[model samples]
Target: MKVGFIQFSPILGKPTQTLERLEYLIDKGKHSDILVLPELCNSGYAFNSRQQALNSSESVADSKFIRFLHEKSNKYNLYIVSGFCEKSDKDLYNSSFLVGPNEYIEVYRKSHLFLNEKDFFSPGNTDYSVYDIGICKIGMLICFDWVFPEAWRILALKGADIICHPSNIVLPDLCQKTIPGHSICNRMFIVTANRIGTEDNLTFTGSSIICDPRGNILTQASDDQEEVMISDIDLNLARDKSITSRNHIFLDRRPDKYLDIAKAIEESV
Candidate 1:
Protein backbone atom coordinates (compact mmCIF):
# COMPACT_ATOMS: atom_id res chain seq x y z
CA MET A 1 0.00 0.00 0.00
CA LYS A 2 1.08 3.58 -0.65
CA VAL A 3 0.81 5.53 2.61
CA GLY A 4 1.98 9.02 3.53
CA PHE A 5 1.54 12.32 5.39
CA ILE A 6 0.92 15.95 4.38
CA GLN A 7 2.99 18.35 6.45
CA PHE A 8 1.77 21.95 6.35
CA SER A 9 1.01 24.93 8.52
CA PRO A 10 -2.71 25.37 9.02
CA ILE A 11 -3.76 28.99 9.46
CA LEU A 12 -5.86 29.20 12.59
CA GLY A 13 -9.43 30.59 12.40
CA LYS A 14 -9.33 30.72 8.61
CA PRO A 15 -10.75 27.44 7.39
CA THR A 16 -11.67 28.67 3.91
CA GLN A 17 -8.20 29.83 2.87
CA THR A 18 -6.51 26.92 4.60
CA LEU A 19 -8.72 24.31 2.96
CA GLU A 20 -8.22 25.92 -0.42
CA ARG A 21 -4.46 25.78 -0.04
CA LEU A 22 -4.65 22.19 1.18
CA GLU A 23 -6.80 21.20 -1.79
CA TYR A 24 -4.31 22.74 -4.16
CA LEU A 25 -1.40 21.01 -2.45
CA ILE A 26 -3.04 17.62 -2.54
CA ASP A 27 -3.87 18.06 -6.19
CA LYS A 28 -0.21 18.72 -6.91
CA GLY A 29 1.23 15.95 -4.73
CA LYS A 30 1.98 12.34 -5.58
CA HIS A 31 -0.79 9.77 -5.27
CA SER A 32 -1.18 7.41 -2.31
CA ASP A 33 -3.73 4.87 -1.05
CA ILE A 34 -3.74 6.25 2.50
CA LEU A 35 -2.98 9.87 3.50
CA VAL A 36 -2.73 11.38 6.98
CA LEU A 37 -3.10 15.11 7.55
CA PRO A 38 -1.99 17.16 10.54
CA GLU A 39 -3.98 17.64 13.73
CA LEU A 40 -6.83 20.17 13.57
CA CYS A 41 -5.97 20.66 9.91
CA ASN A 42 -9.35 22.26 9.19
CA SER A 43 -9.91 24.42 12.30
CA GLY A 44 -6.20 24.82 13.20
CA TYR A 45 -4.54 24.42 16.59
CA ALA A 46 -3.36 26.78 19.38
CA PHE A 47 -6.73 28.26 20.30
CA ASN A 48 -6.69 31.48 22.31
CA SER A 49 -9.71 30.70 24.46
CA ARG A 50 -12.45 28.18 25.10
CA GLN A 51 -15.01 30.31 23.26
CA GLN A 52 -12.72 30.64 20.25
CA ALA A 53 -12.13 26.91 20.23
CA LEU A 54 -15.87 26.30 20.43
CA ASN A 55 -16.56 28.78 17.62
CA SER A 56 -13.95 27.12 15.47
CA SER A 57 -15.25 23.56 15.99
CA GLU A 58 -17.53 21.89 13.44
CA SER A 59 -20.25 19.39 14.20
CA VAL A 60 -19.43 15.82 13.25
CA ALA A 61 -23.02 15.36 12.07
CA ASP A 62 -22.93 18.35 9.69
CA SER A 63 -19.52 19.75 8.81
CA LYS A 64 -18.21 21.33 5.65
CA PHE A 65 -14.71 20.10 6.51
CA ILE A 66 -15.88 16.51 6.79
CA ARG A 67 -17.64 16.86 3.44
CA PHE A 68 -14.49 18.28 1.94
CA LEU A 69 -12.50 15.30 3.19
CA HIS A 70 -15.02 12.83 1.80
CA GLU A 71 -15.02 14.60 -1.53
CA LYS A 72 -11.24 14.51 -1.68
CA SER A 73 -11.10 10.87 -0.62
CA ASN A 74 -13.54 9.89 -3.34
CA LYS A 75 -11.81 12.12 -5.86
CA TYR A 76 -8.42 10.55 -5.23
CA ASN A 77 -9.70 7.04 -4.54
CA LEU A 78 -7.88 7.12 -1.22
CA TYR A 79 -8.43 6.76 2.50
CA ILE A 80 -7.89 9.97 4.51
CA VAL A 81 -7.27 9.98 8.23
CA SER A 82 -7.44 13.61 9.37
CA GLY A 83 -7.59 15.61 12.59
CA PHE A 84 -10.66 17.75 13.14
CA CYS A 85 -11.77 20.15 15.82
CA GLU A 86 -15.08 18.49 16.53
CA LYS A 87 -18.24 19.86 18.12
CA SER A 88 -20.38 17.06 19.53
CA ASP A 89 -23.43 18.41 21.34
CA LYS A 90 -22.19 21.15 23.73
CA ASP A 91 -18.66 19.73 24.16
CA LEU A 92 -15.57 20.26 22.09
CA TYR A 93 -13.10 17.43 21.45
CA ASN A 94 -9.64 17.31 19.98
CA SER A 95 -10.62 14.63 17.53
CA SER A 96 -9.66 12.91 14.27
CA PHE A 97 -11.61 10.65 11.91
CA LEU A 98 -11.11 8.34 8.95
CA VAL A 99 -12.95 8.88 5.63
CA GLY A 100 -12.80 7.04 2.36
CA PRO A 101 -14.67 5.32 -0.44
CA ASN A 102 -17.22 2.68 0.66
CA GLU A 103 -16.40 3.07 4.34
CA TYR A 104 -18.47 4.47 7.21
CA ILE A 105 -16.93 7.43 9.08
CA GLU A 106 -15.09 6.45 12.27
CA VAL A 107 -13.96 9.11 14.77
CA TYR A 108 -11.31 8.93 17.51
CA ARG A 109 -11.01 11.75 19.98
CA LYS A 110 -7.68 12.65 21.58
CA SER A 111 -7.59 10.94 24.94
CA HIS A 112 -4.59 12.88 26.24
CA LEU A 113 -4.54 16.68 26.34
CA PHE A 114 -1.25 18.55 26.23
CA LEU A 115 -0.39 21.67 28.23
CA ASN A 116 -3.12 24.32 27.68
CA GLU A 117 -5.48 22.13 25.63
CA LYS A 118 -7.23 21.12 28.85
CA ASP A 119 -8.67 24.63 29.11
CA PHE A 120 -10.32 24.52 25.69
CA PHE A 121 -11.29 20.87 25.08
CA SER A 122 -12.76 18.03 27.06
CA PRO A 123 -10.82 14.82 27.66
CA GLY A 124 -12.13 12.34 25.09
CA ASN A 125 -14.59 9.83 26.55
CA THR A 126 -14.41 7.38 23.68
CA ASP A 127 -12.37 4.22 23.51
CA TYR A 128 -9.59 3.69 20.96
CA SER A 129 -11.01 2.71 17.58
CA VAL A 130 -9.49 0.76 14.70
CA TYR A 131 -11.24 0.80 11.31
CA ASP A 132 -11.07 -1.99 8.76
CA ILE A 133 -10.73 -0.65 5.22
CA GLY A 134 -10.73 -4.06 3.43
CA ILE A 135 -6.96 -3.95 2.82
CA CYS A 136 -5.81 -3.33 6.37
CA LYS A 137 -6.93 -2.36 9.88
CA ILE A 138 -6.20 1.33 10.58
CA GLY A 139 -6.08 3.05 13.96
CA MET A 140 -6.37 6.75 14.85
CA LEU A 141 -4.69 8.68 17.67
CA ILE A 142 -4.26 12.41 18.06
CA CYS A 143 -1.20 14.51 19.07
CA PHE A 144 -0.53 14.00 22.76
CA ASP A 145 -1.52 10.37 22.85
CA TRP A 146 1.80 9.43 21.21
CA VAL A 147 3.44 9.70 24.60
CA PHE A 148 1.25 6.97 26.02
CA PRO A 149 2.55 3.47 25.24
CA GLU A 150 -0.69 1.93 26.46
CA ALA A 151 -2.66 3.69 23.74
CA TRP A 152 -0.37 2.23 21.07
CA ARG A 153 -0.56 -1.22 22.64
CA ILE A 154 -4.36 -1.12 22.78
CA LEU A 155 -4.57 -0.52 19.04
CA ALA A 156 -1.94 -3.19 18.43
CA LEU A 157 -3.93 -5.66 20.50
CA LYS A 158 -7.04 -4.75 18.51
CA GLY A 159 -5.28 -5.95 15.33
CA ALA A 160 -4.44 -2.61 13.76
CA ASP A 161 -1.84 -2.80 11.03
CA ILE A 162 -1.26 0.93 10.87
CA ILE A 163 -1.67 3.78 13.32
CA CYS A 164 -2.25 7.16 11.71
CA HIS A 165 -1.16 9.96 14.04
CA PRO A 166 -2.46 13.47 13.38
CA SER A 167 -0.46 15.99 15.34
CA ASN A 168 0.35 19.69 15.78
CA ILE A 169 3.52 19.01 17.68
CA VAL A 170 5.57 21.57 19.58
CA LEU A 171 8.09 19.32 21.27
CA PRO A 172 11.21 19.01 19.23
CA ASP A 173 12.34 15.54 18.10
CA LEU A 174 10.82 13.77 21.08
CA CYS A 175 7.82 12.00 19.58
CA GLN A 176 9.65 11.24 16.36
CA LYS A 177 12.46 9.53 18.22
CA THR A 178 10.10 7.69 20.53
CA ILE A 179 7.74 6.42 17.82
CA PRO A 180 10.29 4.01 16.34
CA GLY A 181 10.38 2.27 19.68
CA HIS A 182 6.60 2.06 19.67
CA SER A 183 6.60 0.58 16.17
CA ILE A 184 9.16 -2.06 17.15
CA CYS A 185 7.31 -2.87 20.34
CA ASN A 186 3.85 -3.08 18.82
CA ARG A 187 4.95 -4.43 15.44
CA MET A 188 2.70 -1.92 13.61
CA PHE A 189 3.29 0.64 10.92
CA ILE A 190 2.93 4.29 12.02
CA VAL A 191 2.29 7.40 9.96
CA THR A 192 2.91 10.62 11.87
CA ALA A 193 1.46 13.70 10.16
CA ASN A 194 2.71 16.83 11.87
CA ARG A 195 2.22 20.52 10.95
CA ILE A 196 4.87 23.19 10.54
CA GLY A 197 4.87 26.97 11.31
CA THR A 198 4.07 28.95 14.40
CA GLU A 199 0.72 29.77 15.97
CA ASP A 200 1.00 32.57 18.51
CA ASN A 201 3.98 31.82 20.75
CA LEU A 202 4.12 28.14 19.86
CA THR A 203 6.25 27.08 16.91
CA PHE A 204 5.37 23.60 15.66
CA THR A 205 7.98 20.98 14.90
CA GLY A 206 7.17 19.47 11.52
CA SER A 207 9.31 16.40 11.04
CA SER A 208 6.51 14.12 9.93
CA ILE A 209 7.50 10.46 9.69
CA ILE A 210 6.47 7.01 8.36
CA CYS A 211 7.98 3.86 9.80
CA ASP A 212 7.61 0.12 9.25
CA PRO A 213 6.67 -2.57 11.76
CA ARG A 214 10.33 -3.36 12.40
CA GLY A 215 11.14 0.32 13.23
CA ASN A 216 12.57 1.17 9.84
CA ILE A 217 12.04 4.83 8.92
CA LEU A 218 10.61 4.53 5.46
CA THR A 219 10.22 8.23 4.70
CA GLN A 220 10.70 11.41 6.69
CA ALA A 221 9.96 15.12 6.10
CA SER A 222 11.89 18.24 7.02
CA ASP A 223 11.38 20.09 10.27
CA ASP A 224 10.01 23.20 8.56
CA GLN A 225 8.63 22.25 5.16
CA GLU A 226 5.19 22.01 3.66
CA GLU A 227 5.66 18.64 2.00
CA VAL A 228 4.06 15.29 1.34
CA MET A 229 6.10 12.27 2.46
CA ILE A 230 5.14 8.87 1.03
CA SER A 231 6.32 5.31 1.30
CA ASP A 232 5.32 1.94 -0.13
CA ILE A 233 4.25 -0.46 2.63
CA ASP A 234 3.97 -4.25 2.66
CA LEU A 235 0.81 -4.66 4.74
CA ASN A 236 1.70 -8.21 5.65
CA LEU A 237 4.74 -7.18 7.72
CA ALA A 238 2.55 -5.54 10.36
CA ARG A 239 0.30 -8.56 10.69
CA ASP A 240 3.07 -10.64 12.17
CA LYS A 241 4.01 -10.21 15.85
CA SER A 242 6.77 -12.79 16.12
CA ILE A 243 10.20 -11.46 17.01
CA THR A 244 12.08 -14.77 16.71
CA SER A 245 11.69 -18.54 16.97
CA ARG A 246 10.42 -18.48 20.55
CA ASN A 247 9.30 -14.87 21.14
CA HIS A 248 6.20 -12.93 20.17
CA ILE A 249 5.29 -9.34 20.99
CA PHE A 250 1.62 -10.07 21.77
CA LEU A 251 1.39 -13.73 22.71
CA ASP A 252 4.04 -13.37 25.41
CA ARG A 253 2.47 -10.43 27.26
CA ARG A 254 2.21 -10.74 31.05
CA PRO A 255 -1.07 -8.91 31.61
CA ASP A 256 -1.69 -10.38 35.03
CA LYS A 257 1.33 -8.65 36.53
CA TYR A 258 0.35 -5.20 35.16
CA LEU A 259 -2.97 -4.80 36.99
CA ASP A 260 -1.88 -1.62 38.80
CA ILE A 261 -1.64 0.22 35.49
CA ALA A 262 -5.42 0.54 35.34
CA LYS A 263 -5.89 1.85 38.88
CA ALA A 264 -6.69 5.49 39.54
CA ILE A 265 -3.92 7.75 40.85
CA GLU A 266 -5.34 7.97 44.35
CA GLU A 267 -6.00 4.23 44.52
CA SER A 268 -2.45 3.48 43.43
CA VAL A 269 -1.12 5.86 46.05
Candidate 2:
Protein backbone atom coordinates (compact mmCIF):
# COMPACT_ATOMS: atom_id res chain seq x y z
CA MET A 1 0.00 0.00 0.00
CA LYS A 2 1.34 3.39 -1.04
CA VAL A 3 0.34 6.14 1.42
CA GLY A 4 0.64 9.87 0.77
CA PHE A 5 0.75 12.51 3.49
CA ILE A 6 -0.41 15.99 2.46
CA GLN A 7 1.25 18.69 4.59
CA PHE A 8 0.07 22.26 4.00
CA SER A 9 -0.80 25.52 5.66
CA PRO A 10 -4.55 25.77 6.13
CA ILE A 11 -6.21 29.08 5.36
CA LEU A 12 -7.76 30.40 8.54
CA GLY A 13 -11.56 29.95 8.65
CA LYS A 14 -11.79 28.80 5.04
CA PRO A 15 -12.82 25.27 4.21
CA THR A 16 -13.13 26.07 0.49
CA GLN A 17 -9.45 26.95 0.19
CA THR A 18 -8.44 23.82 2.09
CA LEU A 19 -10.58 21.68 -0.20
CA GLU A 20 -8.98 23.27 -3.25
CA ARG A 21 -5.49 22.47 -1.89
CA LEU A 22 -6.52 18.87 -1.22
CA GLU A 23 -7.98 18.53 -4.72
CA TYR A 24 -4.78 19.77 -6.30
CA LEU A 25 -2.71 17.24 -4.30
CA ILE A 26 -5.04 14.38 -5.15
CA ASP A 27 -4.63 15.24 -8.82
CA LYS A 28 -0.85 15.47 -8.41
CA GLY A 29 -0.39 12.24 -6.43
CA LYS A 30 -2.60 10.01 -8.50
CA HIS A 31 -0.65 6.89 -7.61
CA SER A 32 -1.31 7.03 -3.87
CA ASP A 33 -3.66 4.40 -2.38
CA ILE A 34 -4.43 6.53 0.64
CA LEU A 35 -4.17 10.35 1.01
CA VAL A 36 -3.93 11.53 4.63
CA LEU A 37 -4.41 15.14 5.77
CA PRO A 38 -3.96 16.98 9.09
CA GLU A 39 -6.22 17.27 12.13
CA LEU A 40 -8.75 20.15 11.85
CA CYS A 41 -7.46 20.89 8.37
CA ASN A 42 -10.84 22.33 7.50
CA SER A 43 -11.31 24.58 10.54
CA GLY A 44 -7.70 25.75 11.03
CA TYR A 45 -7.80 25.15 14.83
CA ALA A 46 -9.44 28.52 15.45
CA PHE A 47 -11.13 28.05 18.79
CA ASN A 48 -12.10 31.14 20.74
CA SER A 49 -14.92 29.42 22.56
CA ARG A 50 -17.40 26.58 22.27
CA GLN A 51 -19.78 29.03 20.60
CA GLN A 52 -17.14 29.82 17.98
CA ALA A 53 -16.56 26.17 17.09
CA LEU A 54 -20.29 25.55 17.11
CA ASN A 55 -20.81 28.44 14.76
CA SER A 56 -18.17 27.17 12.34
CA SER A 57 -19.10 23.48 12.54
CA GLU A 58 -20.79 21.63 9.67
CA SER A 59 -23.06 18.62 9.48
CA VAL A 60 -21.63 15.45 7.95
CA ALA A 61 -24.97 14.54 6.35
CA ASP A 62 -25.66 17.95 4.85
CA SER A 63 -22.10 19.15 4.19
CA LYS A 64 -21.43 19.55 0.49
CA PHE A 65 -17.70 19.71 1.33
CA ILE A 66 -17.76 16.26 2.94
CA ARG A 67 -19.78 14.93 0.00
CA PHE A 68 -17.18 16.39 -2.35
CA LEU A 69 -14.42 14.63 -0.36
CA HIS A 70 -16.30 11.35 -0.74
CA GLU A 71 -16.66 12.07 -4.46
CA LYS A 72 -12.95 12.75 -4.72
CA SER A 73 -12.18 9.39 -3.09
CA ASN A 74 -14.31 7.58 -5.64
CA LYS A 75 -12.95 9.64 -8.51
CA TYR A 76 -9.33 9.06 -7.56
CA ASN A 77 -9.80 5.46 -6.37
CA LEU A 78 -8.09 6.32 -3.06
CA TYR A 79 -8.97 6.20 0.59
CA ILE A 80 -9.39 9.77 1.86
CA VAL A 81 -8.67 10.55 5.50
CA SER A 82 -9.30 14.25 6.24
CA GLY A 83 -10.09 16.21 9.36
CA PHE A 84 -13.07 18.53 9.88
CA CYS A 85 -15.11 20.28 12.55
CA GLU A 86 -18.10 18.00 13.02
CA LYS A 87 -21.32 19.22 14.60
CA SER A 88 -23.45 16.26 15.63
CA ASP A 89 -26.44 16.41 17.99
CA LYS A 90 -25.60 19.92 19.25
CA ASP A 91 -22.07 18.89 20.29
CA LEU A 92 -18.93 19.92 18.43
CA TYR A 93 -16.14 17.43 17.69
CA ASN A 94 -12.63 17.59 16.30
CA SER A 95 -13.06 14.66 13.93
CA SER A 96 -11.40 12.81 11.08
CA PHE A 97 -13.16 10.52 8.63
CA LEU A 98 -11.74 7.51 6.85
CA VAL A 99 -13.60 7.78 3.57
CA GLY A 100 -13.52 4.84 1.20
CA PRO A 101 -14.24 5.01 -2.51
CA ASN A 102 -17.86 4.04 -1.87
CA GLU A 103 -18.69 5.58 1.54
CA TYR A 104 -17.32 6.84 4.84
CA ILE A 105 -15.69 3.77 6.39
CA GLU A 106 -14.97 5.02 9.94
CA VAL A 107 -14.64 8.20 11.97
CA TYR A 108 -12.00 8.78 14.68
CA ARG A 109 -12.65 11.75 16.93
CA LYS A 110 -9.67 13.38 18.71
CA SER A 111 -9.52 11.64 22.10
CA HIS A 112 -7.09 13.84 24.07
CA LEU A 113 -8.19 17.32 23.13
CA PHE A 114 -5.42 19.94 23.36
CA LEU A 115 -5.18 23.22 25.28
CA ASN A 116 -8.33 25.33 24.86
CA GLU A 117 -9.75 22.38 22.88
CA LYS A 118 -11.57 20.97 25.90
CA ASP A 119 -13.51 24.23 26.03
CA PHE A 120 -14.69 23.95 22.43
CA PHE A 121 -14.75 20.26 21.49
CA SER A 122 -15.98 17.16 23.26
CA PRO A 123 -13.40 14.42 23.86
CA GLY A 124 -13.90 11.14 21.96
CA ASN A 125 -15.34 8.24 23.96
CA THR A 126 -13.98 5.16 22.20
CA ASP A 127 -10.49 3.65 22.62
CA TYR A 128 -9.38 2.67 19.12
CA SER A 129 -11.14 1.13 16.14
CA VAL A 130 -9.62 -0.89 13.29
CA TYR A 131 -10.77 -1.18 9.68
CA ASP A 132 -9.78 -3.81 7.14
CA ILE A 133 -8.31 -2.19 4.06
CA GLY A 134 -7.08 -4.58 1.43
CA ILE A 135 -4.73 -7.02 3.26
CA CYS A 136 -3.92 -4.84 6.32
CA LYS A 137 -5.79 -3.97 9.46
CA ILE A 138 -5.52 -0.12 9.65
CA GLY A 139 -6.10 1.83 12.83
CA MET A 140 -6.74 5.61 13.10
CA LEU A 141 -6.20 8.06 15.98
CA ILE A 142 -5.61 11.78 16.46
CA CYS A 143 -2.77 14.06 17.76
CA PHE A 144 -2.43 14.06 21.54
CA ASP A 145 -3.81 10.53 21.82
CA TRP A 146 -0.49 9.27 20.43
CA VAL A 147 1.18 10.19 23.75
CA PHE A 148 -0.81 7.48 25.52
CA PRO A 149 0.52 3.91 25.26
CA GLU A 150 -2.91 2.42 26.01
CA ALA A 151 -4.37 3.77 22.75
CA TRP A 152 -1.78 2.06 20.55
CA ARG A 153 -1.84 -1.10 22.71
CA ILE A 154 -5.57 -1.49 22.08
CA LEU A 155 -5.03 -1.25 18.32
CA ALA A 156 -2.07 -3.61 18.39
CA LEU A 157 -3.88 -6.18 20.54
CA LYS A 158 -6.85 -5.98 18.14
CA GLY A 159 -4.46 -6.93 15.26
CA ALA A 160 -3.70 -3.61 13.58
CA ASP A 161 -0.63 -3.53 11.36
CA ILE A 162 -0.68 0.17 10.53
CA ILE A 163 -1.64 3.11 12.74
CA CYS A 164 -2.54 6.36 10.99
CA HIS A 165 -2.28 9.52 13.11
CA PRO A 166 -3.73 12.82 11.91
CA SER A 167 -2.03 15.51 13.98
CA ASN A 168 -1.08 19.20 14.35
CA ILE A 169 2.28 18.62 16.11
CA VAL A 170 4.95 21.27 15.60
CA LEU A 171 8.45 21.45 17.20
CA PRO A 172 11.23 19.37 15.61
CA ASP A 173 12.35 17.99 18.96
CA LEU A 174 8.97 16.38 19.73
CA CYS A 175 8.50 14.89 16.26
CA GLN A 176 12.11 13.88 15.74
CA LYS A 177 12.66 12.41 19.19
CA THR A 178 9.39 11.38 20.83
CA ILE A 179 6.92 10.36 18.10
CA PRO A 180 9.26 8.06 16.13
CA GLY A 181 9.99 5.99 19.24
CA HIS A 182 6.24 5.19 19.41
CA SER A 183 6.49 3.06 16.28
CA ILE A 184 9.47 1.20 17.74
CA CYS A 185 7.72 0.67 21.08
CA ASN A 186 4.41 -0.58 19.61
CA ARG A 187 5.97 -2.52 16.73
CA MET A 188 3.47 -1.05 14.24
CA PHE A 189 3.77 1.29 11.29
CA ILE A 190 3.11 4.96 12.23
CA VAL A 191 1.85 7.32 9.56
CA THR A 192 1.45 10.84 10.99
CA ALA A 193 0.13 13.75 8.88
CA ASN A 194 0.40 17.20 10.45
CA ARG A 195 -0.59 20.78 9.52
CA ILE A 196 1.43 23.93 8.67
CA GLY A 197 1.32 27.81 8.79
CA THR A 198 0.06 30.43 11.25
CA GLU A 199 -3.52 30.23 12.46
CA ASP A 200 -4.69 32.54 15.26
CA ASN A 201 -1.17 33.49 16.40
CA LEU A 202 -0.04 29.82 16.41
CA THR A 203 2.49 28.98 13.72
CA PHE A 204 2.63 25.31 12.73
CA THR A 205 5.90 23.93 11.43
CA GLY A 206 4.80 20.86 9.54
CA SER A 207 6.90 17.70 9.93
CA SER A 208 4.44 15.07 8.79
CA ILE A 209 6.12 11.68 8.72
CA ILE A 210 5.79 7.92 8.15
CA CYS A 211 7.76 5.36 10.17
CA ASP A 212 8.10 1.60 9.78
CA PRO A 213 7.52 -0.96 12.54
CA ARG A 214 11.24 -0.82 13.31
CA GLY A 215 11.00 2.98 13.92
CA ASN A 216 12.75 3.89 10.69
CA ILE A 217 11.60 7.20 9.27
CA LEU A 218 10.52 6.27 5.77
CA THR A 219 9.69 9.83 4.62
CA GLN A 220 9.04 13.18 6.30
CA ALA A 221 7.73 16.55 5.19
CA SER A 222 10.03 19.51 5.75
CA ASP A 223 9.08 22.17 8.26
CA ASP A 224 7.40 25.39 6.98
CA GLN A 225 6.74 23.90 3.53
CA GLU A 226 3.75 22.56 1.67
CA GLU A 227 4.64 19.07 0.52
CA VAL A 228 3.41 15.49 0.32
CA MET A 229 5.39 12.53 1.72
CA ILE A 230 4.81 9.15 0.10
CA SER A 231 6.01 5.69 1.05
CA ASP A 232 5.27 2.24 -0.41
CA ILE A 233 4.33 -0.36 2.20
CA ASP A 234 3.96 -4.06 1.51
CA LEU A 235 1.27 -5.57 3.77
CA ASN A 236 3.09 -8.89 3.82
CA LEU A 237 6.19 -7.13 5.16
CA ALA A 238 4.35 -6.08 8.35
CA ARG A 239 3.15 -9.64 9.00
CA ASP A 240 6.64 -10.92 8.34
CA LYS A 241 8.15 -8.40 10.76
CA SER A 242 5.62 -9.22 13.51
CA ILE A 243 6.06 -12.97 13.30
CA THR A 244 9.83 -13.04 12.72
CA SER A 245 10.77 -10.66 15.54
CA ARG A 246 11.86 -12.41 18.77
CA ASN A 247 12.91 -9.34 20.81
CA HIS A 248 9.85 -7.10 20.72
CA ILE A 249 9.74 -4.36 23.40
CA PHE A 250 6.00 -4.68 23.92
CA LEU A 251 5.99 -8.50 24.14
CA ASP A 252 8.39 -8.48 27.08
CA ARG A 253 6.07 -6.50 29.34
CA ARG A 254 5.74 -7.60 32.99
CA PRO A 255 1.93 -7.47 33.26
CA ASP A 256 1.77 -9.08 36.70
CA LYS A 257 4.06 -6.39 38.20
CA TYR A 258 2.06 -3.67 36.41
CA LEU A 259 -1.20 -5.04 37.83
CA ASP A 260 0.17 -4.79 41.36
CA ILE A 261 1.29 -1.20 40.63
CA ALA A 262 -2.19 -0.37 39.38
CA LYS A 263 -3.73 -1.90 42.49
CA ALA A 264 -1.44 0.17 44.71
CA ILE A 265 -2.43 3.34 42.86
CA GLU A 266 -6.12 2.51 43.23
CA GLU A 267 -5.76 1.97 46.96
CA SER A 268 -3.80 5.22 47.41
CA VAL A 269 -6.16 7.31 45.30
- Highest TM-score: give the candidate number: 1
Q: Residues 1-269, candidate 2: write the lDDT tens digits.
A: 78888888766567788778778876776678887888887777867777767766787777766787788788888887777788899788888878877775687888888787888888886558888877577888887887777788778777788887888875444754666777776677878888888767677768888888777888988878988778998665455434345754546667777665446556877
* Candidate 2 residue pairs that clash: none
- How many clashing pairs does model 2 include? 0
Q: Candidate 2: where are CA atoms >4 Å away? A: 241-254, 260-269
lDDT of each: 0.91, 0.77
- Lowest-lDDT window of 10 residues in candidate 1? 21-30
Superposed on all Cα atoms, the candidates' RMSDs to the truth, in angstroms, are 1.3, 2.5
Report residue 94 deviation for candidate 2 (angstroms).
Answer: 1.1
Residue-level lDDT tens digits of model 1 in 180-219: 9999999999999999999889999999999999999999
Model 2 TM-score, all chains together? 0.90
Error of 1 at 15 (Å): 0.3
Best by lDDT: 1
